[model samples]
Target chain A: MELAAERHGDMLLVRVAEPRIDAAIAIQFKEAMRELVADGAPRVVLDLAPVGFLDSSGLGAVVAVRKSIGPDRRLELAALTPAVARVFRLTRMDSIFTIHPATPGPEPTANRQAAPAAEASLPDGADEA
Target chain B: MKPEPVLAKRPAGAPRHPPDDPAAAGRAGAAGRGHGTTALQASRAPALQAPHCPDAGGRVPQTCSGTLRITLPATETGVRRGLAQVFAALRQGVLAGAVARDAAQGQAGAAEPVPQVPQSACDRIELVLAEALNNIVEHAFGPEPPAPATESRGVTAPGLIALDLSAGAAQLHCTIRDAGRPMPDGQAPAGRPQDIDAAADLPEGGFGWFLIRRLTLDLCYVREPGCNRLSFVIPLSAEDPPRPHGL
Candidate 1:
């Protein structure tokens, strides 16, 4: 998996380029997030659009990232593919994080308290399969 | 001295194997015709006999619900081969049990129900087992063989690597042990060491241990005098307790 990060306003957007995030890479996922949070970014958005699969380990790493952001800071997950979304449902973590459905339009605007997402169209190059 | 076969006559539809067949030793591909049925019959004994362990420390942990051990040479290839064999057996056993239970609960022509842990879990099992076995190959095998290993050789000392599998009512347990030096301080030999403060954006090593920790409910590492042992357990079911109380 490849993780790329950039600063946008007070929020740091970390994009992971990978096919799956599970036990195979959970450790690296945690480590990469820890590195991103070390800068003390008040908000972080994790783009998992590239992820094709997510398991319990992947979920735990995301939770750890949320905790790392601290209560004062904000953490959000974006561009979750349907397959990845199923994992969130399986573990019921969908209720815990801000999951912006991968919409066909531009990236969803950042909101400190992310508004609840409604089913939306898919972005280009993002196949439902 | 010839002894009566512990296995009873094969049942109809059960695969048949000669009493001395090594292929039927492990629960992999060997079709025992009605081996599942035979195993069901065997399981009825309920002698409370736990799986065997070759080493004293190989004893099942108090938290473990059940345990089994398989022996293979302590070589790179041997460790890999042994892991594949044992893991397949465990998965097959669980799959067979689920199938038998569903069939027994229903009549013929009924749909064969699927297992909770589907075949997809096979990949996850491989990932988890590989991490545990890697420790044995690297740390347990020690620095390097005093002499180069060759494929044709047989029965030579290949150091000491043992695969121990235990299952709690709610969890699946795997332990790998080797007679090697104690783990270095904060520096694991085989994979990345535990790091709590590393960056989240950089692509780097040190993810395997973290994956192991996240994948398993609990992990324990022990360096007793001569052996380095690593054990990990994952909950067997989403609804079941990790292990039976007092087990």
Candidate 2:
């Protein structure tokens, strides 16, 4: 459950340093994320580049974090490894979040619109706000 | 970061051959004796075996395989260790088969490469195992059942989950047995996750069975008098071209 949080402008980037997010650490992850985003920025970008595996519980934890953040704020995902991306794709969760190819640097606004294919992959009304 | 090693290395001089007794072997073997048996069981009666095909050297490699069986209490810690140990056994079996294949080709002198299981296959297996095992610990055992309650009192002592894994050249077979409540209507759940547009109605659970059904082949669930057995086969990837014999 190694997670690092940093503030980059209005967005808070939380990177999961572990390679796996399974039942073993799913609850811990959700609690950690809740604490990180408790009094932080509205926009969040979860960097999952280092995470090579994510099970259903891990996927559910991510969804739980998003729901905790509320709909007014956005919970975007960035730098999903192929294995992690496949889980999201198979579960159809790719439709729910704005996913980026990598962690966005300084110019966050441009990165949001960088991956249009991801945007196109989202379900209806997911792109709102 | 690379995924943490789920399987540990076997101790030096550990027994290579499976136990002699058929009942012991079936209980400990990767493949179990059952009505709905997989191809591995049909071709190799005892345990998973490397193919006997002769290599370019015209020598058939001796089949080498092993089975591990352990019944653990249906606790979170127990489930975690059970999954890790079984998965590790599966990995070892696959690697051993690959080594045998390489030896048949007379490439034993070449640096023994660290056998690599395909990442996609590994991911699918991990995901399915996690969901299934967690479901058992959480639902089947009813969170934390009181210790020492007699079965006659309708309170079973630390439910037991037994895992059997067998790895063949073309596929890996897994069988999990548990004495827990049967699924609703005595049928395994099916279908995809619910289609949700509103965040309020989004589901946090109920995705376990769906993923298990989708990722596995020949998936079957049967309820015996007092136990539930779930078995599935995961096909190995054929992307890697056959290694040139004696290369």
Candidate 3:
């Protein structure tokens, strides 16, 4: 449930500092994200680098967070750990969100087009995932 | 900021296992009575001998490859812990080594049926397990400690989930028993994926059963009086090259 937010230029980068986002913390996570994204930059990128696992409840929370962010602002996902990516892929939620690899270091205001992430083999230690 | 994970206080008859431990409670020994695996396990040698069960190694001795069982409270944390224990075994403990041995000694054990399974299947198994267990926690047990947790009604104590997984060469045969509310109409719901194209209002829920059905095969659910038993199978991943022993 540890989510750290940083202003990455025009975008806000919120790194999930926890190992998992499951049923146990789904509500809490959604509420926290609601607060964090309420008045941030026009774009919010959830860095799921530290997450080792995410279940259906967590998936729901992510979608709910998107809804709460409203239609005007953008909610993109970045650094999806293998497990997290798999959840999004299997559920086909990947189609909706603009996913990036490693928070897309260079481009913020320059490019709005979220190129599909090379999620097949992210170089994270989640080799196990 | 991570909010403190203190959920509603536990009832008087709360479980004794450490609270909200991702590892400790997940340390639920899932190796339940692997009957008849002792002799084969003994020959496989040293690493299998988990301290808890001397006669049998750290694995479920029921199958030549491996079988695992875990009994835990019907709580989110409990489910998380239970899943952790099984995968820990599958990756680092007896199950991994056994899978390795089965592949390495393929020529010799051609008679026995331990499919050449990939190591990655461990993750899928763990994922499906998390969903199934979480469903029981969120629905069956009804949001962990009930509202009147202080009532201390020994009559309606917290539920317990007993999950048994037998890792066959082809697929994983699983049986989960829980003392909780039965599935509506005593049937496993057909988890159909909703139209994601409706961009206006994205769905938040109903993905649990869909994932469970997607990742698993031949699912069946039965309610026996006071208990609910659900069983299913998950096909193993495409085979991979055999690794050296103790991988």
lDDT of 3 by residue, B30-58 (tens): 22211212112212322332112212333
Ranking by DockQ: 3, 2, 1
lDDT per residue, candidate 2, B1-247, as tens digits? 2111122234343233221222221122222211122121112223333232111133434643543443445655455555554543543443344333443355557754434455445556666776787787777778573332222222123366665555554456777767788777777777466565676667776677767776677888888667777788765552211222321
Q: For candidate 1, lDDT tens digit of each residue in A1-129? A: 478777877878787766556544667889888987788888788877655445445666887778777778878888765445544543335556676664222354542112222133122222111
Query: Stretches of candidate 3 above 4 Å error?
Result: A106-129, B1-20, B23-65, B96-106, B109-119, B146-158, B238-247
Model 2 chain B worst lDDT window (10 residues): B33-42
Each model's TM-score, in the order given?
Answer: 0.41, 0.67, 0.72
Ranking by TM-score: 3, 2, 1
Evaluation by TM-score, superior candidate among 1 and 2: 2
Fraction of native A-B contacts kept, per candidate: 0.00, 0.32, 0.57
- Candidate closer to the true structure by lDDT (higher is better), 1 or 2: 2
Per DockQ, the best of the predicted structures is: 3
Once model 2 is optimally superposed onto the true structure by TM-score, how far is the C-alpha of residue B139 displaced, in angstroms? 1.3
Model 3 TM-score on a 0 to 1 scale: 0.72
Error of 2 at B147 (Å): 6.1
Write the residue-wise lDDT of candidate 3 on A1-129 in tens digits.
578887867788887766678887899999999989976589999877656678889999999999888888899988775557777876778889998876665544312322223243353434224
- Candidate 3, pairs of clashing residues: B26-B81, B30-B69, B34-B61, B34-B62, B115-B169
